[model samples]
Target: MAEESGGHATTLGVRVEAARREAAGVTSYVLTAPDGAELPRWSPGAHVDVHLPSGTVRQYSLCGDPADRRSYRIAVLEQPAGRGGSVEVHRELRPGAAVQIGLPRSNFELVPARRYVFVAGGIGITPVLPMIRQVAASGIEWELVYGARTHGHFAFLGELAAHGDRVRTVPQDTAGVIDLDKLARGAAGAAVFCCGPAPLMDALVDAMAAAGHAGQVHLERFGPVATPVRDAAADDASGPEFVVELTRSGITVPVPRDVSVLDAVRGAGVDIPSSCEMGICGTCETTVLEGEVDHRDDLYTEAERATCGAMLVCVSRACGRKLVLDA
Candidate 1:
């Protein structure tokens, strides 16, 4: 979704200027500088890591205007059954509360495109909301296929309505699930950006791959995905070492069996920003120049992995002796 230099993720202290309810169980918090100053700049598909008062950290996509440096807005959905981070945010992060936040990191950053197709489900719309605005303002051809539990469950329907016929609202209560095959067929030659529940994201990725359009797809995984428990000892004992050539940094580093590419790259002084090193967060996604990968990340489908256009450097490794990376 983007091209930016990756480095250490920094932390900042900010105050919640306002908190407005966006939808049922959804709250949008506007965070601003504590001393009437401007916040860091961020592009579309960016998100910040919020350290809650209860010591739980959660990442939320920036849904506000990127031009507005005065404040940064993020929407959170109360996931009572899933995790405690959202619950804590909905309860404690009210207006006037001071909170610690991470600088915006965007694995889902929006790049220039020919045509754009955005498929968002439920709370997944947060990252796509700003993308739509940016694309629409650029006079680029784009459309959004948004689905929710019900019509009222939508957070920014009012804002979406301004775009007229380009938005397709599919409420699952009355209409069935979005037809993945149809959506993929219609998105030919268009760059597809999808962020949604696991099922929808998984199915659409398969559909896109089956249609031979995997190269133009981008994704943002909002929540955690199931991953096999990583046994570091087992990996250290059996993992194979490989050489990585960082084209951008004009350097090469040896990735030992015990260490990951993320650590190797960072150790070599080329810092690729990462979060949730388990490969579920998609933050360590790096462009692949050559060599097949033993893809260990949950972010890519089986067919998408075959493309090998990118890999999550945190947990994924090389399938050959030498690999070239665009990082």
Candidate 2:
């Protein structure tokens, strides 16, 4: 299969060209467009949304080189409790299989800094690995602190080890435990980018706060954190079905309590652009011209939510009588 160009149309059909096992329970798949042409270009931190057979969609980081236009490489870890996405990708997806994918997009970008410290935990290393490669190629001063339960469970261990002093593998069994305080204390001027489990991220946050380096810390959360449920009294008072107005199409669709605004809009055969239907990625964000949103996504910052102009359609719900969406 050939890769598709970025501009002809909004939807692009792709096919799995090849698949390889990278590590225990981890595999990488190369996908290309159906035209058998070179793939579209993407930046270092870009990722694509893969539509799985179970009708569940998930996001995977593009670990391959950005210059490689022939195909997009994505690594997936077979999560034990995953909602079928990763498991199906590892067990069912094969070369030549047809699938739907979103365009490359990213929110975790590498910014200019004097120095960089990358912390990767378990499979969260997917996105950071590309950044590490880019930084190393540029001869920049950077370090990677990779952590996993054991050496065998760690992905890309050999590749990371080749960097010698530039990489630190902190296997839980060998290193006892990762000490975020000691790791982040002295890195004052360096920018810290971390992607990992919630406990690891929380510890990093605390360590950075204690070291007065909160402003220098940037993080990408691969999964959603558990959020407390709203009080029963705080539920939508009317429990009314509302109308979602699509700005471009000038169409209004009915959104019921059982159906999300995304489903309602999509049912009308409108493509609003979405990936990681769990709301982990900000790909489905749309402008909100009217109505209050019951924000449920973790991707948006408090400030972004307060702007009152955009909302993530996957998990967020409407708080007002109706939502006017600019799809």
Candidate 3:
């Protein structure tokens, strides 16, 4: 998800113009300006941070046409066992209800490529929907492998049906899980974009790597990438504690093995606005004045890391014994 820039947060008041069931336990919402004005421009693969009336904030991908500025459409999957945001969206948000939304931002940008392959699972299809539309409109060669728990759980079938054979639906209940190996083999020279559950993404990553197409694969994740659990034995051998200097705050703190850089900064009474403390959200991003970063986040691209100027403080640590941050 995107971050609030400059630590200043602003929300636009938008009214729920329409709501309809797209699939089982999933609802599509169309939000528009109350005064019928044009909303902020957003490209494909963008998402808005929705601030629910119940005081919960959640990010939902904008799946509507990028050309449309009158309204933004997003789909929500009711997750009973997960956070309350989805629950409130499903049960409370309705037509005529007012909502606060942040500006649309995209982390998963679709770069120009010769061909594209999209793989989506469950609600993860939302981000890929608009991407497929863009690629198809450009007359570019593209295909989609969308999967869900059941046939009824798949959304946007009517919209995607016009593409015919270009789109493949795999209902896991009827068919088994999507064969990533087969897809990977077929996606030899294509740029593969995937968004789904962690396991599904992990499988795609492994498959793409095995097919020697890892560099062409791009993904969008709602949560942090899973890291291995470090036991005491692992921490003992992890290495020496690093020192982090907050340039703006003028404080130097020792980041111990047991704590993260984010926690260390907060412990020193310096507040850095953050959400999704796991490093998936770009909220806690800090400028690296000096020192290499042991990037543990999946947000930054290789080019961004090459600059060695920015790092996600939530999970990323210092590569050397000493580091400086432009807090």
Each model's lDDT comes to 0.86, 0.82, 0.87
**lDDT (tens digit, per residue) of candidate 1 on 185-295:** 888889999998988988898999898898878888755566677677755544468889999889999999889999999999997866577777766789999887778
RMSD of each: 7.0, 3.1, 3.3
In candidate 1, the residue pairs with backbone N, CA or C atoms under 3 Å apart (3 or more residues apart, or in different chains) clash, namely 1-109
Please, what are the lDDT tens digits per residue for candidate 3 over residues 184-238? 9899889999998999999999999999889999998878777787566644444
- The Cα RMSD in angstroms, rounded to one decimal, for candidate 1 relative to the true structure is 7.0
Per-residue lDDT tens digits for candidate 2, residues 1-327, read: 223435444445788899988777989898887787877678877888887877677888998888788788899999879677888888667999988777788878898888999998888888888888888889889998889888887887777887999888888988866788987797799989888888899889889999989888888887777788666566667444678888888888888877877788999988766666767798788899888888889887789789858888878878867888877
Best by TM-score: 2
RMSD of 2: 3.1
Q: Which has the better lDDT: candidate 1, or candidate 3?
A: 3
Evaluated at residue 243, the lDDT of candidate 3 is 91
Question: In candidate 3, which residue ranges exceed 4 Å CA deviation?
Answer: 1-10, 230-259, 263-271, 290-292, 319-324
TM-scores, in order shown?
0.74, 0.87, 0.86
